[model samples]
Target: MVGIIGYGVYIPRYRIKTVDIADVWGDDGEAVAQGLGVFEKSLPGPDEDVATISAEAARNAVKYAKIDPKEIGAVYIGSESHPYAVKPTGTIVAEAIGCSENMTCADFEFACKAGTAAVQTCMGLVTSKMVKYGLAIGADTAQGRPGDALEYSAAAGGAAYVIGEEDPVATIEATSSVTTDTPDFWRREGEDFPSHGARFTGEPAYFRHVEQGATNLFKKMGTSVDDYDYFVFHMPNGKFPVAMGKVLGVPKEKLEDSLVVRHIGNTYSGSSMVGLARVLDIAKPGSRIFMVSYGSGAGSDAFSIRVEDEIQSHRGEVPTVDDYIARKTYVSYSVYAKYRRTIKA
Candidate 1:
């Protein structure tokens, strides 16, 4: 019975309101905020690259897992934003988190779904006894081509999960996945941000993938969305997940507080896992949590998890979504452009 032994998350310290970006262009930020349900998005500093963000999340997860660094047998980093195109960010993260050299390490990419994809893969390694414990990290520093609508919500953040044998903190009961060759959003080589068909990204990319993944998981398990204590979805923006929930017959009441859209923006690869970490902060023993993640170029992964009695004891170590949101410092468009290195100094 392999499961999630511990979890952690990292959100950058800077924030930029949609209005701030809109204000500079004579556009109404209020309308954008209202439509997207996002007030601000996080921005990383020069020193905090994807590796650093992943390292922080791994540290927090290890702390809560109560496992020694040397005991970790594998590490998988999921990021489309690896700092170096040629080198592996997983090794750097393993070192930063103090994992042993005996561990297996690699990076995975599937857009935003890569994180949970790593989770599913790690579970396989543990269940098969190929390793004692494994770490899966989802981190991203998403770029939205300057002045694009994505620029207002595409953000940076990371989350890490430790997967191992049963008697664990959060156990995976079942899992399901769906994939299709859909180009709702994509970026070719040498592209900084992604390219999307705009309106198509919602129905074709996000909603379709998530709804199918969740429905298939629930139907096969013979359980409905109402049976779960909480639900989380990949939030590219606020509206997509909420809309998907409605179409899937998920109770509106169950989703209200769990949607992380307005507060954290769309964290690309880290979106759904980060939201799961938020729910873990308040989830009770015996609670069931359902999670679904979608990546553009389109794919979705869904999982069923049952919280253990130990969850309450470990929640204190991970920072809440609110904690991260409050510490953010604001930056103007000019400064944002400089930080992103989109402009020549």
Candidate 2:
């Protein structure tokens, strides 16, 4: 009975087309878009940050759970973009969400999979009776160096999950994680943007870690990809998930609805959590879900979720992920640059 009691996501309405970047750099827009399988990416408004996004998602999760916020005994936020170098984003989120003063809170950074790591921690706390209800958030204002390959895909957004035993929307069937010390991406102290290992970010990094996590989950739970109705992977871009799905024998249709990285880019820690929220929005009462998340440091977390009956009542109650997706307003590269603060006046 221990699982997600509620979930919510916050994605900015602003977007810049992938072709816009190629246009600026005199690269092939069509080829770039087709190659990455990402056409656009969400951009945070000047007022938005990891804290604001986390607060919105946490508030929505509380509302969806229909519980007193004071009952929240723990809050964990996963993100690399904590506003302060030393302050904890979890406490800010907890205070904004109205969680109790004596709450267990911390911020996590494991690259993109940080959000799922928070989820795993909350699950443990709630199931262990250490917390009545725990809040787990994955949010990021991810950035890419201008003209870099990641510029088109590194973007901003986040999602939150409330986990408990009371009236869950889904139940966790199984979970597994695999990690290695491989360095495919890094941003040094005081570095403005991250540097990647170029061709190394793919083969031995993202794909290898994600595939290993998925394969381990399959063997651990004795469940096949065919057992799930939908599948979601850490979408650094549209291409990676599809390519990994193929390697794992998952059909395109099963991965389609959750393949949102094509539209929103990578939200870093929020990447896969947002995808899971989208899947839950349309999942049937008995549908099964498969999710695997990858962080650039070379690690992946995989989980199996079975939709609960309570999901039917809440599916249309909140702002649908589709609504956010369709309500986008396009922005030019110059405006996008200004919004991201990458361009000095």
Candidate 3:
């Protein structure tokens, strides 16, 4: 009976247009729009970091779950870009959320899919009666080399979900995980930005894992793609998921409602988790959701979710994606550089 009890999301107040990058780099504007499907990306402010953003999202999750923070029994932070190499960001978030001192806390990192991994792990803890409630968070401050195509779309945001046993808001119907021993994308120690085989990133990294993961979940669940009302993927940029969704035979009608890879760029670990939060907000009871998460060390996790009747009454109030995006303050490229810590004093 372990399932998600609540969910919340946070996107920074600053936004950088993809066109701003195109103008400075003298690149094609259409490529930025058509190829990527992202017009703007959320940018974290000077005072924020992975821990701070995770804390904010955790607080909101507490509100949504209608649970006292002291009752939380575990906290997990999932990120590829943790602020400290060794310290657990989950501890900082737990303190901010006011979770008990006895709570379990740790961090998980497996590229973009780490967030889903955190959710799976928390489910195990709650199902085993080890925890009354737990929180899983995905957050990142991704970096891209200046002038690189990735710069325009790799940005920051976070999402949080509370997992518990009874009175679940959404039930996890089934899940499947697939792995491949390949390097579709990677960044070594001391490297500020990741490197990728662009074409391989599509076929081998993103498409292959998502396809296999979803297929396995559908097979195991005795359901097909047509059974789900919506599909959400870990979108690094907009084009990859759109193209893959088309090839995978997901109904075009189902995809029109997706929010990933659109309003916000990829949040690395936060990508699919935030999409899941958005889906929870709009999905009707009895609707099935298919979620596919991919990480570049090359793995994917797929989960089938059924919205529960309980969600309609308890879905807590939080800022909508439209509201958050509308609140964004546009900044100059120079200011973007300064905020990103790319400017040399």
Candidate 4:
């Protein structure tokens, strides 16, 4: 079956509380936390970058898959905060995971959904027999302006999926996407931080795309939301996923396991996929999962996956997402600014 053979996630150890960012902006941290349903955001060390995060996650996937890295025929990394403007972060990740020169590699950027887009591409390669395995990674050291609303949620993390025709932990039943030219968020050349359309990023972009993507996938699969045992939606904030879940008729119990955004903030490209990873960690064999992701270009990708007995097989090779989430070291706003390089002096 063409699906996810293995998956791994990496979250940085540092964190900044919503109160910390609100303290800097003279806004009410409690109200901000209550509004967004996010308490803290994971932060990268000064030494970390997207490439490093991608490599670490891919290594864990290789371990989980128990496959030789050289057997992986392609590598795709999706992120908006790629370290080099022109260099492909995928190449760095491939080499780090011990992939050969013969493997194809590229980077993807469509905001948060780029990661899942990579997943779909990998599925195609494996299904076509062009590759024994393909690695798709959604990683980002996401950026938020000094005082913007995003500062409380934009965070650093990533996940890697090894897609192949065998040893799948979850097999894909169907996938679909919906897109439009919605400019809810953008950062022009050389801008250190991205700009957004405020409330514009919500109704017209995130909500619309995710709803349409999920609805179309359900129709294509000839099933309704009630058929899936679990659901994960792109979480730019904690509330959005929950809101969209209710809109799609999925109950809170189906969404509770996927709601890590409340703790780790939004990992951008890694957002929904990471949420799916959390669900897979605890899901029972034969469980069905529905996932949808949103990006600000904007667009959404939806997928139906069936959990296999294989998920219980390799998930213990590395620390779980919850393991990483529990191992945090909080930093003050000043230290966060320094590590994120918002201040030079």
Candidate 5:
């Protein structure tokens, strides 16, 4: 079966509390934190960017897969915050991870769901025998205008997966997607930060798309929420996914393990991917995982994944998601502004 041979995640160590950001903007930190359900958010260091974050995650995946990088036939780096507008971020990642020159490479942008799109692409390539193995990464140094609500949630992180037909850690049973031309969020060509439709981002965009995508997948696979052992949904903030779980009839326990957003904020393209990694960290063999990722453009991609027995042998080959979460140094709003380059000279 074609599926994930290995996976890895990277979260920047620098974090800023939601309360600290609220204090800078003269808002009540407790109220804002309660409203968003996010206590803190991550930020990149002065040298970290999407490319570096992606490369690091990919290297970890390669290490976990225990395969020669030269065997990877395709590389896709998906992000809204790609370092170069003109060059493909995938090439840099491929080279950094020691991939051979003969592989195909490209960059994908679908806002927060771009990474899942990459994973789907790799799945197609491997299933078609067009590639022996493929690498897909979702990473972002997400942007937020100072004092905007997004400043509290826009964050940096990434995850990578190695996909192939070999003995995999998990096998993808099905995947589905739903898309529409709803402008819930956007950034113009020269705009420094994104703009959203406020309340419009909820019902008509994220919720509708995610619901439809997941429903379509359920219909295709003939499975219900109770069939899955774990659940992961895109987390723009801590609240949306929890609310979505209720709407989808998923048990709270099924989603609790994947709630990394409560501490790290939204990593844009990396959001649901990192959450999935967190679930994989503890899922047992034969566990079924239901995942749906929403992108604000807007759309959602749903996946049905079943854990394989191979996971037991590979556990702890690389640092777990909790390892990164625990290895943090808190920063103030001013320091966060400097690292994010939100403050101009």
Candidate 6:
């Protein structure tokens, strides 16, 4: 079966609370936090960036997979916050994880869903027998203009998955996607931060694409919401996915464990993939997981996955998602500004 052989996630150690951010701007921290359903967001250290985060996550995946990196024939890193405009982050990741020189490598950017796009690419390659394994990653050091609405949720982190046909931790049963030419969000060529259409990002962009993607996947798989044991969606904030759950009739318990955004904020490309990792961290064999990722531009990729018995043996080898969430140090807004480079000398 072409599925996830192993998965790993990396969240930055630093965090900045919503209240701290709001305090600087003279907004009501309690009101802002409650509205967005976000308490705090992650912050990349001055020495950290997309490349570093991707490499760390990739190494963890390699450890979890217990496979020779030389066997991985493809590597793809997806993010909007790649440190370079002209270079590929995939090469750095492949080399960092000790992959063979004979593999193909590239980067992807489709906003938050780019990582799932890379995962789909790996699925295709593995299913075709073109490669024994493929490494897919989603990571970002997301940018938000100081005091903008996005500053409260735009955060940094990453996740990596190793896809192969062997003893997989989770088997992918089906996948589908939906796309539209919606102008809900964008960052211009020279712009440091993205611009959004505010509420337009909700109805026409994220919700429309994600709902359609899930609907299409259900149709393709001949299943419904109740068939899955868990559900995960791209969490631009804690509120969007919960609201989506209500719209889709998913029970609160089924979607609760994946709401990492409540603490880490939005990890952009890493959003849904990291949520999936959290679900997989706790899921038992035979548990079914339904996941959908949304990207502004815009599009969504949905997948139906079933946990395998192999997960029990491999999941404990590395730190769980909760471990990363618990290992954090809060940063002041001024320190955060400096780390994020929001303040000029």
Model 3 alpha-carbon drift over 4 Å, by segment: none
TM-score on alpha carbons, each prediction: 0.97, 0.98, 0.97, 0.99, 0.99, 0.99
Tens-place lDDT per residue, model 1, 1-345, is: 789898888999987889998887778999989999888888888788889999999998999888887888889988888899878999999999888888899998998888888888898899999988899988898888887888888889989999999568989999999999998877888877788788998777788888889989999899997789888888888888888888877787666666666876888888888888888877889999999999878899999999999777777676776677678799888888888888887
The model with the greater TM-score, 1 or 4, is: 4
195-271, model 2: which lDDT tens digit per residue? Answer: 99999999999999999999999999898988999999999888989999999999989999998888899999999
Write down the worst ten-residue block by lDDT for model 6.
312-321
Candidates' C-alpha lDDT: 0.86, 0.90, 0.85, 0.93, 0.94, 0.95
Better of 2 and 4 by TM-score: 4
lDDT of 6 by residue, 1-345 (tens): 899998899999999999999999999999999999999999999999999999999999999999999999999999999999989998888989999999999999999999999999999999999999999999999999898999999999999999999999999998999988998999988799999999999999999999999989999989999999999999999999999999999999999999999999999999999999999999999999999999999999999999999998896788888999999999999899899887876
Q: Write the per-residue lDDT of candidate 4 for residues 258-344, one digit (tens) a residue.
A: 999999999999999889999988999899999998989899999999999888878679878899899999999999999998899
Clashes of each: 0, 0, 0, 0, 0, 0
Candidate 5 per-residue lDDT, tens place, 1-345, comes to 999999999999999999999998899999998999899999999999999999999988998888899999999988999999899999899999999999999999999999999999999999999999999999999999888888889999999999999999999999999988999999998788999998999999999999999999999999999899999999999999989999999989999999999889999999999999999999999999999999988899999999999999888788999999998999988888888887775
| Rank list by lDDT | 6, 5, 4, 2, 1, 3
Instruction: List ranges where model 5 is wrong by over 4 Å.
Output: none
Looking at model 5, how many pairs of residues clash? 0
lDDT of 4: 0.93
Clashes in model 4: which pairs?
none
